[model samples]
Target chain A: MLKKGIKYTVALILLLIVGYNSVYIKKLSEVKAAAATGKFDATLYAQTFWQEKLTPGLAKANNLPELLTLLKSDKENAFKNYSHALGIGNLRYFLIKGIGKITASNENDISVTLLPDSVGQEVKLATEFVYGNAVRDALGILSINDFSNTMDMNNVSAEINKKIRTEIIPPFRAQAKKSDVVAFTGAIELNQVHLRLDEIEVIPVSLNLIQK
Target chain B: MSPKVFVKEEKAQVQPPTLKAPAFSGSYSRYLVKFQSLIALFILCLIISLLSDKFLTVANGWNVMRQISVNICISVGMTLVVLTAGIDLSVGSVLALCGAITAGLLKFGIELPSQDLFIGFTLLGVVLAGLLTGTLLGTFNGWTITRFKVPPFVATLAVLTIARGLTMLYTKGFPISGLGADFAYIGTGWLLGIPVPVWISGIIVGLAVFLTNKTRLGRYIYAIGGNESAARLSGINISKVKTTVYAIAGGLAAIGGIIVTSRLDSAQPNAGISYELDAIAAVVIGGTSLSGGRGSILGTVQGAIIIGVLNNGLVLLNVSPFWQQVVKGMVILLAVIIDKANSKSE
Candidate 1:
């Protein structure tokens, strides 16, 4: 009877612990999903859009036939292609390939690891776009200001602004435009090009790509 | 048959006997040699005073006191534990755990709804957490030693690793910072021109003295350390008493951790990593036998003061930090040698 009582109590305790953990995990997942769409989500969307622009657009399209013919006949208008046509090709690559590996899912609130391999082999651009000290992350970083002390969001905003301005902004400026040259098998594979002018807006856009 | 005659007869019957001289002089010379710690402390202070100009300064002395305050406080408890032939390697980790719990409680409290309960409950929670954690750990060490019949060294060594690992797990290798202002006052603030830590250490040392000198529980600890089998035969409730000793030691260690964290304004998971070594060294240097029994609180106090002075003097002299460790170890060895030589002669 003593052994039976002990077994029953142990089983009940284990069940309660498991149940509690499951509920806690479910709540955590919900919070993470909600977080993926907030102001922080703007960066994720922009990165996704760049990744989609790379493989699908240029990999499928061929020759700027009309633009090339115009270019062959009139060399003076080539400057227009440089500003308009070349820029479009660069943007497309940036959106499709460059941005894919720049952002990924966060495992926890205070932790994030950028998955560079999501794009392609020899992913150099992905490394440049990601910021944050892996050592400090492991050792843990303290957020300035007590989140509980005041009803003030100013401290949080200040910290976020410092990180964005100091660490994030400069890199974005450098990688803002994408490369016009696309190489496949060690040669420039610029067989086709499509130059599209879309109106720029404050609203963020995400490029969606489905591989064939 | 008058009253005067009766008084005279009683006086004659109660006549005082002539006094005889004591066999030996009650000279302090004998005691001065026995308490070699007092001699070593005097020599150390003299040497430091002669070596450095800044050593005597008020500000620098305060700094030294502040630095060694936690060590001094914890060594008193360690002295008691060692007196019972038990080692407490877990004290350092216990300190870290207590500090982390204090930080966590405060952080959780601050995040809760702003009510009186938040602050009150937070303080209570932190203190209770320290007490509970320390007592639990001490009990575990005691149980392992007594029940499993494991040697105290082996048992406490296991506890040392386990407690440190748990501390790392709790903080995730991070330091918990931004404790409340009031909490910081315990370590940082001063009372009557002395740092609060010094005052706290003084009070604890006094309490430790009273426990070791005045109480039955304290006597039993020394007795058990002196002879375990004898104490057991005398019905001293060996298990319960030993457990209580460890629990007290653990609790005192937790207090040390709290004071240290508050002083630094953070609970670094690795803060108290090697503090236990210094504590043990202090106890041994104080003329306490490592084999257990036969030590005084006064000697340990002197030992702690000697260590505090040596560390302060080294820094004041601007000696290389690496070499300072070598010097300190040599000094401890030297003091132990002096103590042993003195005891043998006695």
Candidate 2:
């Protein structure tokens, strides 16, 4: 009689587990389908985000006054102006394109003064923020404002920046030696304003030697 | 206790029919005992799922499985340890030590040519260091316990603090990072779309089930747990079995440690902090008798899944971290209470 009770109990437990798991499975598929469209497509976000937002925003600023004016008055707008495409903190990145004359080279980092073209003002390019989240925060694309309290965004910033440093910077370093006119699209941060605007730094996302 | 000891001493002069039950047989009585934990797990799952839509999702299912893989791996070995009527509190510390050793070696010590490195013996040093450290620690624990006649609890507790100290001294409390993709694949890679840790744990669980079910060592373990003197009288080497069980437990814990370190792309010296308690909880909640020798891998699996599900569900429900702790403790207490009550009734 006890054995019968044990067998029935086991059976019932197994059935309950199976039933619960099936319900969970159903919910999982729905989330997967929804996530397939957005939220989890990290690579998709990374690849297309630059062309859509950063370049246009960077082209809008011609001089230190314009960049600083934007920075001081509406820090959110300043970040939003750059990240308006994905919205603030939507990405840890973006891309901006501009032509600059290389004035100096520091190994992987090169100092380029922007050539007045679209924005119509020459400004020194600062790569001093090269080592950290200066580029991620400058872009204001990472959606960090959304989760400021809950997480340390440093690791994610490091991860995205590390890829940029290793994969994107090497060739640019070799090509943009002093005196080269370079066309580049890259990620920069407006974060550390204690430094002058051009001296602040842009981590180049992509670079091309427009003229040797 | 005194009357029993006196009766046993008196019985030494005359043969007596000793009342003994099979240590871990799926016998009718033992089945009822195992069933109690299973029922707890099922009830927990059902309630948690009903309360949270996110708890029942596929992504969360994988998340839970991945989260529990380390616990499951260590628990298998813990089950064996408990089956021998012994406890191993050092498994967590051993995990940290081995994880630190392996990651430190890979990230800073070992150098491989950049080309075709993935297919090379790139991970050989990491694996060797982890497994070797695990074995040595296990042997040390065993040596301290068996040779000095130290209690298993005391021996393992001492080793626990020792191993943690060793880890901190070795890593200088820094996380070892930049292990690269090839090494990371051990934990983060997928096999047939399942996380690599899950695959590895699944295989280890299968092997553990086989080892405990199909080997002479398994039966001997049961014998030792059921009654030590009887096992010794039957010519089983108590020292050897205990050492082997500890060694297996340590080695499995190392595998778990390595996988976790690889998943995070780094190993923190503080990894596996308090994790031994989790593995013990898995074993206990699975209906393994703390007294010794009456448990199954199946029960522990249920116990692990229950834990994983509970954690995932609580987070999905957006409960406060403090409240989550309270709820988790209450549920764990409830599961064990039910298990104890059912066992007593039986």
Candidate 3:
């Protein structure tokens, strides 16, 4: 009699698991179909991410001059408060803005000296080529788990970089001259081990000429 | 409690019959029990070699050994725990925590009480700290079980969550990476043309075999698992032996964590997720009865190799990852069924 009860109990548990999994499997199949056909568009997703999330959130960036001062004094506390990290790795991203005079301009990078406190410390704004996941990761709004695979996540980064290259950098490069005062907001990627306070290389999201 | 009263309580509770040498069966059955897992491993290799050309190469052989090394270390500890009819669900979490702590220490040295005074540990010190963390956690698990009479499963399960939460808190949800070359050498460095992890696991297996076969504590462990009431009547320190076994298991898990961290050059908060399942599978597939007292470290080593080969071969053959999980589960079930049948025949 006990044996019979155990058999029925086991059968019921199996049935419940199967019932729950059926719904899960249906949803999985729908995702599989989209993945199989390459129907999930990462470029469009990135385009929306930029306009909807990043542009409106630019004001949230830490002020470059003030951030540098804090970093010089207390590196650990500064990173604890201002930086963003995703998943389980050693990379930290910072979103920062500063008003500076263009110290030097070139095809590769535009070196700018901050107006008030950071006169000697030059921040390079990449105008010709932009790489890395700075813009995608700096906001900490997009998660790697939300994407189907790493390739999709990488494609988002590529699309974001392409947008900056085409839309943001070209306009700034066309009219801007040497010693021109400009306000720029961008993302910077730093390796925790080799965080250099000397030179900050930024991948610009927006650059506006304040004075010619 | 008196021995007579303890024996009465033990006798009242139903227990599975221990695997004893057959009185009627000849040497053939004895050999089968001894060599079944080995035979299974050999057949698995033969099949994989036939299916994938890459399986027979030296590079691939080393890769398989390297991949199995972490599992082998965890399984060695698991084999000891299972021998006492206990389970440790926290090995995976303990591994992650230990690895995170090790990396955290290596990257940022401990700050002293006095301002501007910091102390950095050498490689040996960092590794010892990792092992100590695992041992302490394991000892706690054992103490909780022995003192409170809590089931090993529940005790370890609680520890699993606690350790994982502690790991995330220490790492602050970020991975610690770029550990110097000196530290990376433990994971990636090759000695005498073999991966370091393989060498480390080999030494562990050898020492475990010696411990189980040659020591009095080993005998006590088996005695407790075979019949606790009988062991108590024999005046064996069951609690001490059980706790020691668990501590050993935790230390081995820490070793595994260190290897994994070194190999990846980063200690991720999510490292060793679901690793306990793999270690359990290795122990079970190696012909160790989950009820305890009748398994060997060599069997676990062979079982780990089989699993590693299957993982490597499936990836080589372009099998889907989902299907691989299904196949691995079936293999474990098949192994247990075969073990049951063999023991019944004996």
The DockQ leader among the candidates is 2
Model 1, B1-346: lDDT tens per residue? 6999999878866764411122133245566667667777888888888998888888987888888888887788789889999888989988888888777666543322322223323454576667678778888888888888888889988988988898889889977776768888988999998899999888998998999999999899999999999999999998888888888888888888889888877888897887888888788788887768778777777778888888888877878889989998997788678767766765
| lDDT by residue for model 2 (B1-346), tens | 9999999888865654342334434376656665766666678778888888777788888889999999999999999999989999999999999999887766445333443122112476567669889988988887878899999999999999999999999899888776767888998888898998999889999998898899999899888998999999999999999899999999999998898888877788889987888888888888787778788887888888877777787777777779977876786677678767766866
Please, what are the lDDT tens digits per residue for candidate 2 over residues A1-212?
99999999999998776545322112334444654684333344344444475455556433343554566677666554553332232233333556778877763357666665444434444333456554545554456444322113455555556667667766666555687898766554443224234444556656788898
Estimate the overall C-alpha local distance difference test score of candidate 3: 0.86
DockQ list for all candidates: 0.02, 0.03, 0.02
Lowest-sum lDDT 10-residue window in model 3 chain B = B15-24
Residue B92's C-alpha lDDT in candidate 1?
92
User: Model 1: per-residue lDDT, tens digit, A1-212?
Assistant: 99999999999998777545322112334444554664233243323323453223334322233323444565345323322222222221111112222222222111111123331322222212222221111111223242322212233333433443445444443433333122110001121233321211111111222111
Q: After superposition, how far is residue A30 of candidate 1 from its true place, in Å?
A: 18
Whole-model lDDT, model 1: 0.63
TM match of model 1 to true structure:
0.59
Show where candidate 1 strays beyond 4 Å: A1-212, B1-29, B109-120
Q: Rank the candidates by TM-score, best first.
A: 3, 2, 1
Winning candidate number (lDDT):
3
